[model samples]
Target: MGDIKPLEIADAVLERYRSLEIKEPDSANWTVIAGIVAEDTRSKQLRVVSVASGCKCPGAIVGKEDILKNNADIIKDSHAEVLARRGFIAAILEDKGLLRSDVRFHMFSSSPPCGDASIYEELDGSLRFTGAKLGDWRRESTEQVLGKTRTKPSRSDSIYRSASLSCTDKMIIWSLLGIQGAFIKTKITLSSLIVAAPHPKLIHSLRAALFRGILDRTHTFANEFCIPPPDLSIHVIANHYSGPAHCTKTKPSHLATAWWLSSYSSVERIVAHTGRLLGARSDSTKHSRLSTNALFELSDSQYQTRSEAKINSQYSILRRRLASRLIADFPADHPRKRRLLAHHFANNDIDESVDMRGALPLAKRSKLSPLPAYLLCSLC
Candidate 1:
């Protein structure tokens, strides 16, 4: 990481994102792009391992084991950052060689992630990030509330709202639990998190956001989990594609995309990942293989669940200790926020810090189900 330039990595991600076929799906729809970029030691250049574009958060799928196993699309969290991270893990799970030999990895997003990090103020009539270091922009900002975790609503007028955490918050949790989510057993570490910065204040705000809120109260919650903060940087890239303006004429709110580096390239509706029209039953097609569950290996120890017919209804833990610690770590000021995070994350606080009598069963149960619900570490 010391030798690598964030600029090189950022440009590689932007270039790869631009090369995608579905990038220009429609003029009316513009989606945020985020992905994991890696240093290709063999080619001595940076390459995008995986990238995705979207703003949909189907959070209920996190606990719905039945839906996860049966659905072909199986997109529980459709934010570009989450999908891209999932794609990188999927690619790694398929080929272990990708992570071998000290190959460095970095996460790049087209814009500042949502929630606490994106808070800003008008400077010369343009929005500039206000939070920096230990600053508390949440209380000062007028557009959004400060305390407690927030949800990125699906739409303004919809009767229901999306349950997904903003990309910024998700990254904070990901740093603690590992981006593998419920997919793999091993942990993959990133060198740094880079966001596009056309100026300086945005950089300051991004720094404050990660240091202050990788998902809020970075000091209290993260320290308990023992996870380090992601190295942060901001670079001026040749292009920062933020997509269309908000409230523009679009269909279905907007069209989001999920894709990765695979033999097949089919961008189907979220309801139909097998390259078919919406509402149609899935088929024996290429995109079906791209489903998150399809990418999982059930027989392998890395796999989270075992659904082989008469086999026991056994699930596995992806980050047992981390889950336990985070639940225990939330500050007293925000009791509800802990539950909010726990709703999606697993909880298995059965380590030395835990009282096994109460936490052990939950830990066991978490390992028994694909979605057992749910952290921060301070050396970060």
Candidate 2:
């Protein structure tokens, strides 16, 4: 991996990645588009097309005139996933010495449709489709299932002769059909939309869990199977589950039920990228550089507030939005929504000592503790 400069322009981005060379960032607000496209193009390995050792294209793969029209959304999705991936993996790679000595890891969010949906945890600690809907939830869930053929009624049918559907089996069937509609009701979380490496230790643990999935066998990131270091940060951009506008219950679950999908096909490039962003070895004499361990430590820390007045005075914008969007979204007619909203607003706006009562169920709390102040302080 080599030092990758902070990508700020489309031309620089195109020059860096051979696959995106033809995809111009100039048309449709190219500057903003460039950074996003470049980041995502790398993160998702979209730019890594298989070629012979000394291969060259005979002609253009996609035409200039219709490129954006045909691939705008595809490009956009790749970009979001890329951004999320960088946040986690960069830290990991920095520790592994696979990245360059000049580039810096960066992460940012993009505008997209937002909302909430329901989330369910199965007995085995796996996510079950309680209900979640996104852009086209209904259409996405429809599927054709093949079941065994049954014979006509007979005088002495064995217990096995008659087909049976267990309640759990039937639920699975129903879930398949209504999954789209149900998924729409759940809110989306950052982890759900993107593939990110948790801390290096977390990634190591996840590798075993994900081994049964496709990620263990194939290279999903950077087109190579590379184990990312434990310190990197990778994040993804995604939308909340879609549902009726008035519902407020789903919003809290997004925060509480945070979990990561195991199979990420995009690890190799991101690992190399993390190495690139880490830049030169940390030097105490140098200014504005933090070691890989420090970066990971800070990202795993938490924030605390002592008073409502102080919280409002300090985080005014955050407070205002929390009150309006979170609290006000609850209607007077819905008691549960109103109460939940009020509790959420208070939990965020003021520093209440940790109390077990009236808190989220123990099972649903986030796996990652709140990030430390220093990690966010620089970004903020």
Candidate 3:
């Protein structure tokens, strides 16, 4: 864990990705790739334990009502970062704290994450004329009034999942709350986070987009909720010709992949298209176990013993506080508060908030209440 040689960690993941020969994506179809590498406590050796590549989400095809209602087991967000984390949790559940602490964990991505990290409203060659470096582009964004949070961009004609936060924001939350997951009732975080594509100019912006934005905040939350930021760096990936932006030959493929190295069983991989397994029959129970619903139901019924019983982890309190930020505004009961929250969230542009009609309202801006978990993830 002490000063990893970096490139090899990223190279291992990239090699793992390139080695996958399933329904591999071609030049016309691209996808984002991300992985979690675990460091051996003794040998200090690095090995990739979990990896995922995807862009589609379940909320894309199904109606918003279906997703929020928990009507079925559907992968909530198929973005590589989220799915990869989901797969990583499988390791934790199998053996608690096996790789949850700073003593051993690293992350890698084939592309810069979307949102604050990936966006730059800068003109090309600006450095040649104005002497502004690429790193200064995001720093200058504050004055342009571009600080508003952005949802994951989707150009598909169909309504995609806009309710969830971008991968960048979620990763920041993970850094704070540990990717061990809520149900696990335990805490674990990344030691380092590395993303592909060498853009030395974007260091400042990438930091702000990754975890610096959260760390730079002045909040009233307890110090226990704060954790040291992961080692963030950039590396020039080999043969990383597939990304949503950097590669024009390949468009981001809707199909997603979730692959995890099982501690007990053989390696498992889930390849999904349009949110469901490829060629899965309608009657077959082929839902991705990593989906939100599956995590709750399956963990409760089966993997309960694998998780520690400590529900009062700093992250648990933080999640409640997040919900409380807005929930505190109303002293009323749950149902009524939800209705009131709809209005509070209406102007906030939170896609997760829905009124009685199960439809999103196009309302103008006003105020924002921090409805933690889903809300904080989306807005941040």
CA lDDT scores, all candidates in order: 0.48, 0.21, 0.51
Model 2 bad stretches (over 4 Å)? 1-320, 323-380
Off by over 4 Å in 1: 23-25, 41-43, 58-73, 124-143, 156-159, 198-201, 215-220, 227-253, 265-290, 297-380
Measured by lDDT, the strongest candidate is 3
lDDT of 2 by residue, 1-380 (tens): 12332222222322323332322222221111111222232443212111100000001012222111211111111122222232233333233322323223332222111112112233455543321111111233421111111111111212111111111121121122211111011211111111222232333333332231212211222132132312222232221212211123222110000001112322211111111111223122221112223323333332243221111122323323323332322223345534543443333211110111112233222222232222221110
Clash count for candidate 2 is 44
Each candidate structure's TM-score, on Cα atoms with residue i matched to residue i, is 0.65, 0.22, 0.68
Native-to-model Cα distance after best TM-score fit, residue 207 in candidate 2, in Å: 41
| Cα lDDT, model 3, residue 244 | 40
Better of 1 and 2 by TM-score: 1
lDDT of 2: 0.21
Candidate 1, residue 194: lDDT: 75
1-380, model 1: which lDDT tens digit per residue? 56677777776776676676564445665566777987765666676788776655532223323232333344444556766776776677566677766577788776666666666443365545422111111233443544334444333321122334455545655665556544444556666777765355446544554555553454344566455644434343334444442234464224455566654565444431122224544432434344433554321434444532121111123244444344444232355544434543343111111111121122222222332221111000
Residue pairs in steric clash, candidate 3? 322-372
- The candidate scoring highest on TM-score is 3
User: How far off is residue 46 in model 2, in Å?
Assistant: 21
List the candidates ranked by lDDT, beginning with the highest.
Answer: 3, 1, 2
